[model samples]
Target: MVLAHAEHSGPRVLNIGEVLAQLSDDFPTMTASKIRFLEEKGLITPNRTPAGYRQYSENDVERLRFVLSLQRDQYLPLKVIKDYLDAIDRGERPENLPPGVKVSPRIVSDEFAAEMTGRVRALTEEQLRTESGASVPLLQSLLSFGLIQHSNGRFDEHALQVAKACVQLESHGLEPRHLRPFQAAAEREFGLVERAVSPLSSRRDAASQARAAEAAREISELCLTLHRALVQDRIARMDS
Candidate 1:
């Protein structure tokens, strides 16, 4: 088991496959690429062996369990979890962290939490259709344009904001039909990630491909998250 690098002398390190096999029963979606992506996101840093192979200790496994559980059960984004872990690493007492954030040196993981912003309210379908000219046909156009997507058969908060923008334009006789340009722009933006992650899809190995595909999804999700924040920030300036 890996302890905090600071807590004990370094011991034997497990390979990537071993790590997955050990945790797959619990985290079915855990993959080597997922592990690497977590590292890229600054969540966990496993030590490397002489040949540059990743060698995770008990601590790494425990941390992985914590992160995977949060993502699977709590629906948190990796960036949120990373921030929480970073705080505890610096000896900070995060208010949301489970009381007594301690792990056995031989055990590899512990649960924790970071401060989070609250949710934004989304406009309802009636608001979309009546105020924004967002009829079902218009909604489909937006989806075709890649400007909108369903969240459990409902439009997301960002879609509502975009729809609101359409409403604002409608006052001047511009309709949702006039927003196809936005959809085209979104397509181009999505294409950026698609091309960047194309190699992952080309790999023939099932496990390797699965992990890479997830990493790509996670990266795109992160981009969407940042994009949402930027859009909201810019909109906030309107009130100022």
Candidate 2:
């Protein structure tokens, strides 16, 4: 469900002029021709009425805001902006998003977007145990089994998440040792992502670096989706 907010079924009530009226205060130079140009470039697809008039939804207006903000603030080229929008269309958060760029909640889950934009406070060992409801022995077992690690005496959001998952699994009779395969599988998947993005990563340009990061993020999300589907399929087979 985290990635399910990409589609919009809202009514497209704003005409092109209405959309321009809403945005022109912020993007003073925004014009009908510019909006049409973005559509021509495949960056946005506004709905069309039977009379051949363009109809823009609230989501469409927010999307235009995202695109224009990137252009005006970051000076990013349309191509790069298109890549970011494409990733959003696929329900992905683009990596290393420029600070303060607003994304539409309709296009991405707020929680997923916050993970990219917000910083998680590092948890102390006691804090981790309290927050995750993990016992000391279980935390020790997780660290011993290489399922989680603390860095510089601090556990991060990831460690907390893993600890919480392990606690839940423990209740189901699965222990830290039983979850080692997941760590290994994660490493293997990350390796595949690294290799896939190597070409873009090797480039020195800012745009290329951004592309590589986005590609890595997108690939990782896809890998997780595949893994989840496979696991679900296996579990479903138990009933058959």
Candidate 3:
């Protein structure tokens, strides 16, 4: 969602004032810093005026809403959300629901949850490095972007995509520094997610807490997917 003039045709610029006006109601805590944070995370990129002011399009606003909604309602970590968005950017529509949940318009059904395990893709470090052309620094960059995680020296399918994205960026002369903004954005997103999950974490039963955690993640994934769909649809209309 970087704020480039659409490579094809579309509404390509939106100012901060406009974004705030549009989003202020649905997202009460919405702020310039938060929007900028999303931009830093590569979640939404607003165009710059001749004077270097930020401009966000309708698409950007919707994307931000989806991102914030997920953080507030679903409690997903930024990294997981980014993977879903990245997949959409790559022209793939993720199942969106978590493991063993059915995909619906508004909620995930239990029938669908059972199938989640089959959809997961687990990759080792060597394969990630090999196929995605990700160097240690690149992996570190992905970590900063909140696009992947490192646990005991391994990564998941999300890591593979981040590695691939790095490879894609290399051709444009971009390196890790180009991705530092993502780290900053991630801090904001983490705060949002944490606040949302606090109630569940404080609860008594372990089972309820676990379910709450899963639901939070699933909800965020759904929002990200929905937002991507909306953006693409709007862009397609513009192109047409």
The numbered model that scores best in TM-score is 2
Residues 1-240 of candidate 1 have per-residue lDDT tens digits of 223433323465677898899899998877899989988877777777678877787677777887787666555567656655654565333233332344332432232121122232344566567666666766666666666666556655567768667656767877657777767767776787777777866765443444455556567788789889999999999999
lDDT of 1 at 149: 65
**Which 10-residue window in model 1 sums to the lowest lDDT?**
109-118
Model 2 per-residue lDDT tens digits across residues 1-240:
222123455555788999999998999889999999988998778777789888777777877888888877777788778878776766455655665665666555566566445643568999999999999999999999988888798998779889999999999999998899999998999899999999989987565777777788789999999999999999999999
Question: Evaluated with lDDT, which candidate comes out highest?
Answer: 2
lDDT of 2: 0.80
- Write the residue-wise lDDT of candidate 3 on 153-239 in tens digits: 767666677679878887799886787665565566666666777787567553345445555666567656766898899999997
Off by over 4 Å in 2: 1-69, 73-94, 97-120
Give the higher-TM-score candidate: 2 or 3: 2
Comparing 1 and 3 by lDDT, which wins?
1
Clashes of each: 9, 0, 11
Please list the C-alpha lDDT of all candidates, in the order they appear.
0.63, 0.80, 0.62
Worst 10 residues of 3 by lDDT: 101-110
TM-score on alpha carbons, each prediction: 0.39, 0.59, 0.39
Error of 1 at 19 (Å): 0.6
